[model samples]
Target: MKIPGLSFSLKRAVGITSAKQKIARATGIPTTKQGLERKIGGAILNAVIGRKRKK
Candidate 1:
């Protein structure tokens, strides 16, 4: 998501669909599919927020 090296393509691939399954499909990171969704949301949110805050 927002983490460094995270790509827009990756996020888009995950999309707004099922975060868990999408995250798992996008990233091979090993974790509970459930947690991965939150992780993706948090990471992406953080990045977006960080950017906005900077503005």
Candidate 2:
């Protein structure tokens, strides 16, 4: 019998996560929400700091 709260990830079982990580690393792009948020936050911080420094 299957558990009510159990789940399975076919992608993880098939190695898709590794492939995505490889592609993200090679292309300098993020494959996850946290990564994308971090990248965007860094860029925004840099832009604001750069403007302050230029003034």
Candidate 3:
């Protein structure tokens, strides 16, 4: 899954053992399994909708 705040590929950059910690450090968003899934989904939605795009 991609981190909303980070520019690179998080899945590739982070190791399985430290994924949570790395993600938290990058985004300051702590999450459990389900919570992380939700966050990832939200990130994808935001990307699709261009939430940060300037109109």
Candidate 4:
């Protein structure tokens, strides 16, 4: 699944617990079972804006 507002890799970076509880507890994204897929999508967006481009 795609935890909204956070990417899979970013989630792992913050904490690789994988458990929804830990993800929420650490990142405080939210524990609700909703459009979590957005996580990666959100992360991707953030990275695009925030992360530096590699060349």
Q: What is the lDDT, from 0 to 100, of the residue 32 in candidate 2?
A: 99
**Residue-wise lDDT of candidate 4 within 1-55, one digit each (tens)?**
7777975467666664467776787885766656466566677877789974443
* lDDT, residue 26, model 3: 89
TM match of model 4 to true structure: 0.28
Write the residue-wise lDDT of candidate 3 on 1-52 in tens digits.
Answer: 8777868556656666487677878886765777678777878988899785
- Specify the highest-lDDT model's number: 2
TM-score-best of 2 and 4? 2
The ten-residue window of minimal lDDT in model 2 covers: 46-55
Query: What's model 2's lDDT at 2?
Result: 94
TM-score of each: 0.36, 0.68, 0.38, 0.28
Sort order, TM-score high to low: 2, 3, 1, 4
Candidate 3, 37: how far from true, in Å? Answer: 0.5
At residue 37, candidate 1 shows an lDDT of 88
How many angstroms is residue 55 displaced in model 4 relative to the true structure, after the best TM-score fit? 31
Q: What is the lDDT of residue 22 in candidate 4?
A: 68
Once all C-alphas are superposed, what RMSD does model 1 give against the true structure? 14.6
Arranged by lDDT with the best first, the candidates are 2, 3, 4, 1
lDDT of candidate model 4 versus the reference: 0.67
